[model samples]
Target: MERSKTVRKGTAYWILGVFAIIWAVITLYPFIVTIFSSLKTNDEILGSMLNLPRDPVWHNYYVAITGAKTLHTIMNSIFLAVCSTAGVLLFGSMLAYVISRKKHKYNKIIFTIFLTGIVLPIYATLVPMMKMISKIDILQPNAFYTLILIYIAICLPEGLFIMAGYMRGISRELDEAAIIDGCNTPQLFFRILLPISKPALATSAIITFLACYNEMIFALLFITDKAKYTVSIGLLYFVGKKTTDMGPMFAAIILTTLPMLVFYMLFQEKIQSGLTAGAVKG
Candidate 1:
């Protein structure tokens, strides 16, 4: 009976392995097709989508970067991503720390308001957001600083929620100790809580940055300036006189996607470790 059970388990594992392989291939099909499509000419792509590039044209990458201004937009996106992420981390963490630790009647009300922003769709406020941006003389969405500020604002609620939860996991003893050692609230927060919350911060930062990085609607609607356009808005480079600019666009898409791929590759382990170690239990 033991031997028979062992054989059945082995057979089940093999069947599952086959299904997993098939699923992986299915998932990867579009990306694989895109890579090959980027290398092939339009005629070749039209002729046979499945065929390998017999003579790969590498200039598509160069053209997409240089001629299509993909590299510049990518640079624009990086700057925006970094600045917006920093703002979210610095401001969001501070807000969370105060709200989570401060025992006041208004604390719950404030936190509830912040959480409600999660369910508020950006589309609902599009017109008002535009009017508000226009109303602020120096705060045009086309301006990089203005755009980053908007990103930070939109990102704050979720970050605040995550950081607040994570902060609760840290003991109040540390705060008491810091206060006894002549530390102010700011100092205790900056010096003690900040270091302890690194994992939660990392998790929130990565998630927020990626969301802002890939966001399209705000980028498209707010920024009319071509030079200030992000990678999400850079897809217009693919549209030509009559049809889509397939070849160069494919290359651009891959180039646009590479940064995210590289970012995940570097920080995926950190994200996993951080979530396990830093997240709150209850």
Candidate 2:
């Protein structure tokens, strides 16, 4: 009986190990190919897709960073992502705190309206958004601030939802105590609630920033100036009407992805904690 059970457990372990390897390959293959392509020259990339580079060309990294347009694009992307994240966190959290703590019929209505934004597909509003942008003339040409506002608007729903859900888990006793101490609404949120909800805040900030960083369609549609283009838009410039430069394009792709990967790696623990905390409480 013992020998039979041991054999069965060993078989299960082997199958699980095989499946893990397959899953890793499925998720990681494209990234591996991108890294491989980034190390090769255009000619080498065209000649061989599967084979490793004979002589690794490291200049692709230099070209990606030192190129004037690429440098500008990187800065634009960083500014948009960071500013949008900040706006969403500050505004969304405040709105969420009010809704979660206050007992009012209008709060429920406002919350529902904000929640509706999540259900609506952003692409469906493109025409209207573009019309407004044209009328406002703020994002004219390639202004980074224009993209920042758009990103903040797009990210608000999710940020609010996550924060409100997190606020539900917080004890009401804290609010009562703050009120007893003569703290106003703004003081209560900034001093007490905001510090305690750091996990959720980090999660929302990272997600919002990444969304703005990776956004392409609106960036392409609104941004006409090369200097104001984000990394996503700038990376596409490597492709021509007739042919695509696979090597440098891959290098640019890797460069664009590296920041996000690093951000995730740095804050992965906080993200996981925030997600888990929200899930468990909500």
Candidate 3:
């Protein structure tokens, strides 16, 4: 009976491993196709997308970098994403710490407000935001700064949600012990809580950065200056009125996607931990 049970478990494990491989193939199929497509000519891609390039056109990457100026747009995205993500993490974690630790009558109300923000669709605010930006001359000077602020505002709710949940799982005994050791609020927060919250912070940063990097509608509408285009807006340059440059476009996408892929790969473990955080009470 024991041997039979062990065989059953082994069979289940084999089935799960096979299913995982199949799922991974399904998930990576399009990305693999795009990478191959980037190396092929437009004609070759159209003829056989599933086939590997007969002779890889490395020049397509050159066209994407030089003609489309993809590197410039990537730099712009990095700046915006970094700045906005910093803002979201700083403010969100501070607010989360307070809401999670402190006792206040308005705590629930504030949490509710942030929860509502999570529920609200950012696209719905585009018109009103555009009108507001139009009226505010200070916001008009630098579109990047404006968009950074907008990204922070929109990302804060989700950041707070993640951070606050994680923070709540932390023991209040830490806070009390820190106070007993003569540490002030700021030190307790910065040195104690923040350090322990690495997984949550990494999780928040990844999500916030992705939102800022991939945001298109606001970037397109708010930023009229071609020089300030984000990666999402820059991709549109390949589409012309008379002709669409498919080869260069696919190359540009691959170039733009690499950084984000690397980032996720680096922090994937932390992100997983953060997602499962707050599940068990300590």
- Sorted on TM-score, best first, the list reads 1, 2, 3
In the predicted model 1, the residue pairs found to clash are none
TM-score of each: 0.91, 0.88, 0.85
Per-residue lDDT for 100-208 in model 1, tens only? 8878898889888887787778688789888988898887778888778888988888778788889988999889988999999889999899999997798778767
In model 3, which runs have C-alpha deviations exceeding 4 angstroms?
A: 1-22, 237-244, 272-282
RMSD of 3: 3.5
**C-alpha lDDT of candidate 1 relative to the true structure:** 0.83
Residues 30-125 of candidate 2: C-alpha lDDT, one tens digit per residue: 789889988898888888778798888888777777663566677788988899999999999998898888898899789878878877788998
Candidate 3 residue 208 Cα shift, in angstroms, is 1.3
lDDT of each: 0.83, 0.81, 0.86
Per-residue lDDT for 47 in model 3? 86
Model 1's C-alpha root-mean-square deviation from the true structure amounts to 3.0
- Model 1 error, position 185 (Å): 1.5
lDDT for each residue of candidate 3 in 22-129, tens digit (9 for 90 to 100)? 999999999999999899887888889899988989999999889888998999999999999999999999999999999999999999898788777778998888
Q: Which pairs in model 3 have colliding backbones?
A: none
